[model samples]
Target: MPASRPNLRTIAEHLGLSVTTVSRALKDGPEVKPGTVAKVKAAAEQIGYQPDARGVMLRTGKTMQVCSILYSPEVGDYGDPGFLAQVESLAQGLEADRYSLVVLAQTSNKDPLEPVIRVHTQRMADAVVFSRTTSQDSRAKYCLQHDFPFVSFGRTELLTPHAFVDHDDEQAAYDAVKRLIADGHRKIGMIDPPENLTFFGYRKQGARRAMTEAGLDPESLIWMRSDVSVRAARDATTALFRTQRDATAIVCASQMTMIGALEALMELNMDTIRDGIGVVGFGGMPFRMLSKQKLAYYYQPQRHVGEVLARHLHDLMVGVPAQELQTLLPYRRIDDLAAFREGEDF
Candidate 1:
């Protein structure tokens, strides 16, 4: 079959180096000589090598491919449109070397570890990156126990530490809720993601902490879980208000959750501003485009996440300690521009 892009054999031929040496140099593997890694990488850029890690593995058992286990980064999927940006950005960053980012889709219904296990058993790639992490995640645990190189988009609890890049969800949630309380919102509500994921717990923890600190009973806050779709959010929000029509503010745990909440309120003939309801959530673009009123939200540098995830994975494959590679990217709070013009670091 015709190659879609340049392969290891092509790089070796162009560099006049053996395929074995080129493979080692690509992965910074054993037997790669000093200065040769530099030469192979340089030629990969000049010649534009799209890596064929599986082909390399066939001969030398080493690869320079990084796989990303992801969901379809469509609107309202997980309230995160950043997932697509991450893959594209990771590809752009890895383009500097022969490393290629391979995307493996993970549906919500499947076991979280299935995709990771596929990579582990097949050895199709050198390392893996995945998101939608849970506390005591099986994927992270398996990767650690098997001595594989991997990076998670969220934290995991294990005896061993591994590379990760994550948003500070707990702190972000706390700050969002605290802002509502400060604004004189008493009957508060929260729309949360599924409780199975670790970030879900972090957001819940932060909101509850903020409520407790204000001398309010955390249990009194209306809490509901939804899929981030307008329909799901509307239903949850409707039920939420049925119990407390006087709820003055809500903390939405996700972009979709926020959007869904807004729709529900509109259906109930309520305007966020008209009804004196304050909305704060995680997401950026859609909030501005969709909402008639300005929204206070938590936004992440998602493209930067891709760049860092790529760098972290490369560092790990080349022997960077997992613990040293852990990072928590802060979420910026974009307050209503009419009231607060700039994003505050949170």
Candidate 2:
């Protein structure tokens, strides 16, 4: 061995003091004399002595590490910025609780639970947080079965008493559709995500509810499902326009979808549709600045939602009740008129 790293024991031996006394002095314990505390501090700094994190964790059973798993989508899919913002906000919130966040990415993997399982089995993190939930999320199910401390960014239909933070996608869709109806757009269309995702179901439900409330035939309204990609949305929009020639309004699931819709409209020489087309998009409004089309959209408080999820995970790890661990954040609607006047779209 080259040279051994210094430890509290070595310091105690060099200072000719008891281990307890040296430990107390190092921590500035009240029991240790002031002069001895100063001397211990100076000695520690001189020797480059640092507390062993593993030892501390072994002693207290707390790693002070919280993990979140991110599933990188297939090649060419435009990831959601709102989801990234949530991760950032969660990190900030966890920092306040003196916990470090460990983000693990599962890229090019079909199994969503792979990274989570690896983190848990390897003892790399104390608690786990997951996002992009499905109707039956395997990650949530695994955590629940193991009785591990965990939280989700979205809710699942597993019937397990686990904590989660989610936005009201149904309400968001409802509000967007209602706004289109208010603009006197009777033949409304929708460009939503695939039906398997839980949020997509909620969003579609809200759209149907709004159409029914407005005395419009829900079945008659045009709908197209797209992957989380602009290309897919564009293709869906093109298909919708080619098929539903009477579509006067469209509600998109995200900003990327809106952009794709705009692209398709442009390609089809339907650019003038913006003047009369009532289009509503979900997600943050920042992307509006990048596009020429003035469209109504929803402002998802992703950062706030992330922070809430982090705090809820912290609480759960510290024994907070499961019932109290759930929270649903609300989204704001931005109509076409308001979307134009807000100086900064972001």
Candidate 3:
């Protein structure tokens, strides 16, 4: 025969306390005194008692958990360090609010939305957080259609109202390009991510806007789009330089792309930031390892983005009527052009 499992009633009877008190103590309810909680925990530990998560969830209408869905099209690797840091910070924030976090990675082979569907259908999580949103994002639309509690790390161009936390990529890109112009770089090049991604599109738009403001022809700027891989970036960089007018400065949308562009520059024996070819990249990179002279980039507050998203989701879960759509964060330039021109180390 299978061994019988311990329940709250059995634990209460063994401790000579009411089942309600036992349940509250186990739930870490504020009403339960610390002394009583200690005693109840001791009794539970003695009997090797474990709370039935499903039963508690059914009673409370909450799983006390949240999930983050990672939509990575590539295979082999699971996630990036920046992404992991965001998840870690978000998990810590949720834990402080008396909640749990579950990470779900979506591969190309599996249905990208399957994990979200399972969690919502099974009532396994109180809310969900979606990252890497694209224009006309079906995932965001689906969540809204079903009335699922969810927030996005990136904003979509779709009209559907949803809560999201994202960096001001447009402004960031504009600032980056403007700084290059201020540094006496006339021929500016831009390496952007795919156009389908709303986030990347905004960044590209910002670059163009800044160029137009500087009295430079928008069409004169060299623009290339590629994946986040080093190989893709290298190919794009090769194509970018093949243009009739070579760029004196290059603005990259991401650190990964910046690295590839640098490799291509080195291969071509072009002294970065020295051959009158300056480079400015958005997002943080390992500046410590790279030559300081060649490194001038923006720093993104990825962890802060996670924290704000988590707080907003918490409020939504607690019945707060947050804005149907909100932009809660701003992006700032990390390095100043004046400072860079002075050869100042930062």
Candidate 4:
């Protein structure tokens, strides 16, 4: 009868049953009689009574909710396409499994793990998924120490076991670089992410390994490191060109950065995949039509990552041990340039 959202107490009062009986019946507890369960279910449906997530967590030590903490300072500005896609996918997947998601954005100066700690302490979330991990990340460590159910979207350099869903960045970068080498391009350059981020470092390592396998001098390869920002990527691209005018190809770590690099290349009047410069970027962008036709790049299923993560969290919540510590999602290359020339619909 109240205007506010219905809770267990309200439902119990309407159904002429104790709150405990109502709660157990709603959860289908064996102690609750089948008739009582039916009555409670029907009453809940009639009044739209939803269990308080925090109260359920307090009573059962499980929150049917997951928090995704975004640590990138430029999360709003740079707008990681993969991250956004994953969030959307994860939300949908969780909803299908009767769970909810909360997004927490952490800025540069803030401790990324603080939100997770607060949520856990307040019994607001059952689990957390962290993105953009670093080597010896304090957030991961904190989660481990607190025995919180958490997973990462990226891997750390640590030896300890932690749940994660990530793409094989090292192998992907290696494969990308090898593709360029096979295309008769030598003196390749890379616009890598900062070393502080383990994923970026792994990508760099893969690129170097690929160069070595191709019998190219690693030292001769131009490499620049910067934050995962458009300006940073643009600056790195400009710097690479300034230092090595003969460099014929550029590898980028992200689509956003690649856009900036492409703009820089256009400004310098360098021919892409024609006169001299060839561009290859990692991941797909929301505004993919802007990319030049036939650009070589690896594309990760951003939405699939989120879907897998949500499934994993659901398994954990349902008393299943999530055994897979790190699940690597699959990726593919868009090799056809002309097919994308007229801007194919996504």
Candidate 5:
């Protein structure tokens, strides 16, 4: 095959130095002489050298590749249109450390971990990163048993030692519910994601907790559960309104769902907020831009999640302790322009 990009071999031959020396210099290995490192870097820049990812993988038994499996970002299958942005952020995070990201397509719902297992057993990647964890995630167990370097975007119920980074979904949900309660919404409703997902349960708990604290019967409220899709959310909202006409407030699980619910209300000619109805949901990025009257939401630390996941996985690959791999980053609540205008950090 033709050389698609500059390789370490090409740089080594140009500088008349061993490929090992070139690799070490590029990585800034402690043992490499500083003068040699500078010379190698200067020569690499002059030749426009771009390290061949495959070659590096072969030499160190480390692909410097992080693999993540998610629904195809191009299709926006996860309801959130920001899926592509998240993937790009992850890629950028990995690229900063000279690592490459392999985003695999999860076309089917059969088993999300199948591709992850394939990649690990086939030695196609260095570390695995996955999200949307369940209560008892088999993928986490598999990685633990095989002793592979991996990190999760959410926590699991398993007791085994593993690394994970997650947003404080429960707290964010609690805040959203509290906002609705303060608005004097008595008959509240929730548009929830599937119950099997770990974050879903956390959010559900938050809503229930807020209702109980306010002396409301959680069971009396409407709960419309659906998959991660705007169409599903729209249909669920339609059904909720059809049944619980008294529902004065609704909380959606995602931004797409919030949009769907809004459209559904518009179709039904229901006056949003004016009819004493309010909406709230969560988003990954640019949450402020999505806000409008009666629509309140928050943005997850998604870019930060990618950055931390990449860095944590790198630490794991380099023999860092598994205990240090876990992190729970805080999220920012974006209610409206006021949050941004008031100098609240996003």
Candidate 6:
């Protein structure tokens, strides 16, 4: 006969605990002590015990799955090393706790609400996580109305508080502009994220505020809304220099955008250091290979962002209050930008 698979009873017997106690400990019931919970989990792992998820769902209304709302790749996130790192870390964190992550991909940004709604209506996941929030996100409202657990990777304009872990994009933008201005680049311009994103305005506001604080005309701070692609940024940069010859600097939304801007300058036969132009943008360590002119750039801890988002969603799943989970982390700045040189890893 085939060997029997280890179940709750197998774990309970191995730990000398009652089946009821073992189950409660595995579920992390409030009544169970943390020590007991840890013991039960360890015993289960050792015994190779697996719960029938269908039965658990029927009894506890828990899906053992979380959902992530994925946006279009063309909207700037395509081939983003930082973004890929963030998602990878987030998945690893959840998998560590036996909770599976289900990514719901969207075809367009025109309807950001559809996937969230589908997850809710179909009981596809216990909680959801999403990014690129707008000023007033209807998806947040829907999740709020249903009391479904969720953690947004970005903030919204909603008056009602919710769980979120967001980077301080405004502060990062402000700092980037201040650095560029300090470098003596007076005529500053930007290629920004899509206008619909709330952070786009936050970044714009920060840039304007920085200029204002420096006694510069905020209104004259040139702005270009791009589709978050290298080609779009290159085209935008070309146009910017064509019209505004006095422009001395460019702040981009992402490393890809900055790369395009650099390409534009290259095509124009203008060197960043030679032409007295400054470049500032946001990205991860991967950008070290592409950096130039020792310019300042903001770096987000993508792995940390993912891990925190995963933890927050798990907290929400375990009945933690949403308001208490809100976090705003400032992006770190690399004061000098230099590309990898001479036989270094690309």
Highest lDDT: give the candidate number.
Answer: 6
Query: What is the alpha-carbon lDDT of model 2 when measured against the actual structure?
Result: 0.78
lDDT tens string, model 1, 1-346?
A: 8756877788889979999898789778867876999999899878888555566677768766789887653343444676777788999888676677888887767887888999989887878988878889998889888998899988877778899999999999889888888988988888876888888888889989999999999888777787756567778888888778788887887777777777778888877777788988785343454346647888875778898888898788778888899999888887654323334332
- Winning model by TM-score: 5
By lDDT, the candidates rank as 6, 1, 5, 2, 4, 3
**C-alpha root-mean-square deviation, each candidate:** 4.3, 4.7, 4.8, 3.3, 3.0, 3.3
**Backbone clashes in model 2, listed as residue pairs:** none
Q: List the residue pairs that clash in candidate 1.
A: none
Q: Which pairs clash inside model 3?
A: none
**Per-model C-alpha lDDT, please?**
0.79, 0.78, 0.74, 0.78, 0.79, 0.83
The TM-score between candidate 5 and the true structure equals 0.89
Whole-structure CA lDDT of model 1: 0.79
- Deviation in angstroms for 299 in model 1? 0.9
Quote model 1's TM-score.
0.83
Cα lDDT tens digits, model 4, 104-152, are 8777787777877887788777788987789998888888788788888
Q: Score residue 186 of candidate 6 by CA lDDT.
A: 85
Between the candidate structures 1 and 6, which one is better when assessed by lDDT? Answer: 6
TM-score of model 6 (CA atoms): 0.88
Each candidate structure's TM-score, on Cα atoms with residue i matched to residue i, is 0.83, 0.81, 0.81, 0.85, 0.89, 0.88
Runs off by more than 4 Å, candidate 3: 1-16, 25-51, 73-79, 108-115, 122-124, 284-287, 324-327, 336-346
Poorest 10 consecutive residues of model 3 by lDDT?
Answer: 73-82
Query: Between 5 and 6, whose TM-score is larger?
Result: 5
Backbone clashes in model 4, listed as residue pairs: 294-337
Cα displacement (Å) at residue 282, model 1: 0.5
| Model 2, residue 15: C-alpha shift (Å) | 15
Report the lDDT tens digits of candidate 6 across residue range 74-129. Answer: 44443355666777789999986788887888776458888888999999999898
Query: Of the pair 1 and 6, which is ahead by TM-score?
Result: 6
Model 5 lDDT on a 0 to 1 scale: 0.79
